[model samples]
Every structure is written in structure tokens, then in C-alpha cells.
Target: MESMNIPMRDILQRILKRRKIRPRPGLNYNLEKQEEPGVSIDLDATLASMDTMEFSLVRENSTRRHHNEGSEDEVSTMADSLTSHQYKSYIVSMVHRLRANTDVQLGVSGEKVEVDPVGSKGTKFFKQRAMTYDADNIASCEVLEEKSTGKSVFRITYLISHDYKHSDFEADSEVCNEIVSKINNILELRLSPARKDYVATRAAKHLRKRDSLRDSFRLSKYTDN
Candidate 1:
């Protein structure tokens, strides 16, 4: 039995050496060659390359952050320069004060004022049409009283010699005063140095964009890769 077992073991060893068994498919197997001997590593060079890559990533992130901050500032500045338009409507005249014109409606927004003629449909063609004016164009706004009826009138005077006098408000005295105050506030805000600077900056930006529209695409050609 021992002699037979020894011969069987020798035969098995020879067969294994001659033909190595292939690994089964769908199995985790490492078939790569072993690492070669005498493969030296330069510690300093490896560290230097890693540091260079890290520095490059930091610089790129910093540049991107700066560009994003600049874009946000530009957007905020542009938004500040724009005017608000939350309009407040007021009944200028509760009753008709003029024979030719009927009641009038006043609308006041951030920096704009609109006056509309409210009359019967039959008289609409002959009545004065609605008009809108900027607060910058208006020189003064005041409440005047008619001598005959003692009713409060909202009057807007332009920078020129023009004056817009609408119908009187027999009951809405406080509303007329509030409208005048709002218009005055808007005018004051427009005259501020910051507001003027923003307006000038926006206008310059528009002009620059317009001038560069044709040549903006050519910038990439001159830029370094």
C-alpha cells in the first residue's frame, strides 16, 4: 500500500507541474507578474510632484472663487441701479371738478408717476389721455387748494415751464400729501451721489458691451492656450 501511494503522489506532482489548472471564470484572481527586483523609489521626487499638483489645484480653486465673487458683485451692483416699480394707486378726485374733464386717477411707483384720465366712455375721446413721467423730470410736487371749492389738488411741476394740474380731491387730502411726499423722496434718492455713480457705470457698461459685441469673439484668438 505505501509503495502504491508513493507512486501515485509522484504522478500527481508531475501532472500538476506540466499543466497548471486555469482559474474558474467569475473568480477574484491575481494574475499580474510579481514586482521586479531593484526597483528604487525617489522619495524627494515623489513628494515634489505631489506638492506641485496640490499647489496647482489650490491656485485653480482660488481663481475660480475670485471670478465667481466678481460676477456676484457685478450682479448686485446692477440690481441696485435699477428702479423699483411697486405702484400705489390713489383716487385723485372723488368727484368731478372740471366741466370738460371727469375724475382722475394717480399711480405712484418707486421713481415713476402716472396720471390717467377717468371719464365716461362717451367723453374718453375728448378727454386728456393718460401720461407717465419720471421723478427725475419732475421739479416739484405740491398740494394746491382751489379758491372757489377749497378742494385739495395734486400738482406736478416739470423742470421746464410746464405744470400738470389735475382735478381736486374733496375728501382725499391725506392721500394727496402722501403722494407728494413720495415723489419728493424719489427725487432726493435719485440726486444722491451713489445713485448717480451707479447710473453712469451702467451706461458705460452698456456702451462698452455694444462696442465690443462685434469683436468679443476674437478675444480667444489672442489669448494664450
Candidate 2:
């Protein structure tokens, strides 16, 4: 019913739950709760529960695709603005040439994203698809980084999901593993020191220029009792 970007989604859910906002007469939000995400992932449920908190930290060490449409979750043109992942996907699709390391990342909604050539990629907005109003579901994703001896050797991640009504973290672990595998194959085949600077630098720019990982509380409607 309510939505908006905020600090860590999980933390927000806990706050809402304790404050007696959840299962009550209201829009929606999240709190500071924890659970085992297991090995599986559900991109759809993850995205649908944008205002809720995380079920597990181990499973949630990933990225999301969202942005404020004037600080409100409901919008006439939800797709006009791009979430971070949506932006990432759009840019990749725009200038992507498969000859490069760019691989299309698909999630539960059957939506796709890609990475740009290891270069200075800007965090800009493009367009988005109309978000379906399914209070019971969401699509979520993560960017995976594999390290070797203190250096990232491989990196890849994507969103996963299941039916909106099903929020079970372990429900789609198998599908999540498969998504990870697809990304890893692409990264292992394309990642290299020569292009490392380009790829790493861009992501670093995003890290430095983007919002904090724990700032979801102040932003989402779920926490805005």
C-alpha cells in the first residue's frame, strides 16, 4: 500500500513490526528482523516486499533496483523513473555488445539487465516498466563479488522472485543458485586484469556516488508510520 526507498529494508521491517504498523490498518513497511535466507532466492518476492525488512543478512548482501517517484511508492508513471538495478540493466542493454563481457541478467519477472564496458558508467535514469501492484509480491536482486586472496576474482549477480504471496526465503534457493551460476560463468569467462580496472572502477564510482546500504529506514513508506 505504501512504498519508497529507505535504509536497510530488513531493519525497516523490524521497526514497523514492533511499532504495530504491520498487519494493521495502513500502507506497508519493514523492521529489524533476521532469518536464514538459505541458499535459495526469490527475486519477485524480494522486489514485491520493497517496504518490508530482510529475512536474512547472508542472503541479502546484494543490490536492489528502486528510486523515489516523488518520495511515494505509488505513482502514475512508475516506469518513468529507474531503480538502481533498473538503471544498471538499461545502460547495459543500451550499449551492450556481446563481444565484450556484458551479459544480460534476468530475474523473476523475466526482466533483463547488463553491464557496460569496463568504463566510466554514470548513474543516470532512463525508463522503467510499469510496476504491477501486487502487495503480496516483489522482485529482488543482488550483485555478487567473489574474492581471491583479498582481490575480487569474479563478480556477477541478479534478481530472483516467486509468487508475491510467498515470502519464504528458502522457497527458491535452487533458482537463486542457478541464477548465480549463470552470472559466474559470464564473469569467469569475461573478467580479467586488463579490463578489471574498467569494470572495478565503474562499480567503485557507483559505490562512492550512490546511497548507503543502511539508509532505507528514513525513506520507505513501511517505516513511515
Candidate 3:
């Protein structure tokens, strides 16, 4: 018996027919070139263009990262400055709040002074309002007593935008004097050299007083013996 050679397509068609899958009867199963030839491509040029695009993308990403980093640093620096300013304001307000005088309702702090006056209707209807003055800008503080009324007036001389300005508050003699003294202390401590000298002088005076007391105590013990 002679063996017969069968096409792969015909075998597949027969298998499909057995499985009840019918192919189009008029369809050609032969493998042949039917369309026009494809155009040739330049592999090297294509690769070079892709490399250039990739390098540009990398450079753009790096530049964006650098810009973001710089913006973050600027924002952080601004936040730090804002925090410092807030802390200074808090310290100023706290100092004024604690030691306010009862009669005048005036308070002095390390950085500023505040005065609260009662309205005609009193504090129940009208909330207490405060006026503030900067200690650093103050050039002078004075208290003057009126002969006719026997009331004391407190005057503050300060600078605003390099121009001299003054604010006046009315209080009794004791309150005015206390406010003036506190303001003067702030002004005197403003200069670093003056503050250092004052501290050194105070320390020397305290040491001398302590030594004198010790000597007196020793002499008293000897006399008792």
C-alpha cells in the first residue's frame, strides 16, 4: 500500500467539519503573497530619536525636582520666621496680662505696655479694650502731675517709621510712677553693654554685702564664747 500526503489546511478543515464547525466553502486556503511589499525602516535612526526623547524626559524630571526642593526650603524659612514673630507677640501679651494695676488697669511687659479703661456703661456692657505701645521704639517715658486736679498724666515718647510720636494715659500718681519705672527698666536693658555693666556692678555690690554679714556673724560668735 502507498502512503498519501495531505495538506495541513485540508486536515484542519476536515477536523473542523467533524466537530460541526463549517468553514466557507469558496474560501482559498493556499498561502500566497497578495499585498504590496512593506516599506523599509531605519532601525539606527529610530533608536537614536528614542534615546534623545528619553534623555529630554529625564532632564525635565530632574529640573522639576530641583525647583520643588527650592520652593520647600523657602516655605520652611518663611514658616520659621512667622513662628518667631508669633512667639515674641505671645511673650509681650503674657507679661502685660499678669501684673496689671487695679486702679489704672495699666500693665507693663518686657516688650510693650497695655492700658484698659472702663467705659461709661462699665465692663459688663462694654468689653475692656486695650491700647498697646512698643517698648523698643519708646524714646522716653514721663509722668506729670496736674496741680489743679491732683491727677497724674503718663506720657510715652516713641518712634513710628523713624518719626517721633507720643501717647498719653491718665492715672493717679502711684500708677503713673510705676508704669514709668517699668518702661525705664525696659529702655535701660535695651543696650547690651549697659546691661552687662549693670549686672557686673550689682554682683560686686551683693558680694561685698554678703562678706560684711559673714564677718559680723563670726565676730558675734567669738564675743559670745
Candidate 4:
């Protein structure tokens, strides 16, 4: 009976050995090969290359931005130059118009003075007055010739009142307003809207100078006391 039991145990052991599951020899080896250290390093290099490409793209975008800025500056400079040229042309045209106006007379003459007869022996007096015609309470406009070249230039000379003094309030007088209106009309006919503003500014400066001269003369007359 013991001998039969031992043989049966041996047969069971053989069946268990035949049916047991065993690990495949190459599975771990394949996994280790897939996860090798060098393979991970290669993936890192690929990521670095992608970063470099992105940096180059950003640099190119910055370059285009700088180029656009430079073009905009050039366009602004060209526009300024064109504006300056138009202003110069407008000035020349204004000068030509003033020169061609026939109403502006050209010359310079001395003031006339009347010498009174001697009173009571060796008592004589002289009265001097401007020979120019008076314009409506403002100033007389005259063109005087240059001494050297005979070229005529416009001059604004203030007129003395019948009360024997210069008028201090002529800056805003009707005559000045009429003169400014005439200048504005001439500029409007010859200049564009953009250039008219510049010419008007210059005309205002001239008028300011004339007004300043009038004020100075009035001050001098009073200070003599």
C-alpha cells in the first residue's frame, strides 16, 4: 500500500510541473531595452530642439516689428518735408501778390516843415509835419525802395492824429481790420487750407510788431515830460 501511494504522489507532482505557469524569458529584457537611459536623453534633446525653433520664431517676429517701426518713421519724415515745401511755396506766392498790387506806392520823401516869420527880432519857430496822406485812423501803408538795389519792400507807417500825437489804440482799429481782411483774402486765394494757417500766423506776427511800435512811440512821447 505504501509503494502504491508513493507512485500516485509522483504522478501528481509530474502533472503539476507540466501545468505550472512560467515567466517568458524575454519580457523583462524587452522592457529594459525600451526604457534605456540613452532613449530618455534623446527625448530631452528633441524637446530642446523644439524650444530653439520657438525662440527663432520669436526673434523673427521682433525683427518684423522693428522693420515696421522704421517704415513708419520714414513716412512721418516725408510728410513733414512735404508740408514744409508747401509752406515755402505759399510764402513766395504771397510775396508775388503783394509786389504786383498797384495800390501800394513805392518811395520815401522828407517831411515838410513851415518856418514862421521872426517875431520881435530873432524869435523864430518851425512847425514840422508828415507829408503822407492819412489812412482811416490806423496807419499808412507804403512801399519803400531799397537804397542799394532799388527793390521795393512794404512798410507800415503810423499816422499822427490832428491833436498832434500818435494814436495808441490803432491796433484794433477798423483800418487794421480791413488790412488784415485783405491779406487773409489774398492768402485764401493762393494757398491751401493746410498752408493758410501758417501764413496767417506770420501775418499776425507782423501786426503785433506794428502795434508794439505804436505803443512804444506813445510811451516815448509821454515820458518826455
- Per-candidate RMSD, Å: 32.2, 21.9, 35.3, 42.3
Residues 1-225 of candidate 3 have per-residue lDDT tens digits of: 000122323333433433355445553222111121122222223222322111111111122233356555644432232122111211111122334423334556665666655433234543435667665666777775444555567677766765666666656466556566666645554433433444566699999999999999999999999
What candidate 2 gets wrong by more than 4 Å, as runs, is 1-171, 192-195, 198-225
Candidate 1 residues lying further than 4 Å off, grouped into runs, are: 1-85, 94-101, 119-125, 146-151, 160-171, 192-225
Reference-based lDDT, residue 13, model 4: 31
Q: Which residue pairs in candidate 1 collide?
A: none
**Candidate 4: residue 16 lDDT (0-100):** 30
Winner by lDDT: 1
lDDT of 4: 0.29
lDDT string, candidate 4, 1-225, tens digits = 112122322322322333352325542110001113222122212222322111111111122223356555644432232122121100100122222221221111111111222222221442222133222222333333323432334334333543222211112233333333333322222233333444466599999999999999999999997
lDDT of 3: 0.45
**TM-score for all predictions?**
0.38, 0.18, 0.33, 0.18
Best-to-worst order by lDDT is 1, 3, 2, 4
Instruction: Show where candidate 3 strays beyond 4 Å.
Output: 1-104, 117-129, 146-149, 192-225
Clashing pairs in 4: none
The true-versus-predicted C-alpha distance at residue 57 of model 4, in Å, is 68
Q: Please write out the lDDT profile of model 1 over residues 120-219, one tens digit for every residue.
A: 4335445556777666666556676644454466666553334333333432566666677666556544563433544566699999998797576667
Computed on alpha carbons, the lDDT of every model, listed in order, comes to 0.46, 0.31, 0.45, 0.29
Ordering by TM-score? 1, 3, 4, 2
How far is 141's C-alpha from truth in model 3 (Å)?
A: 0.4
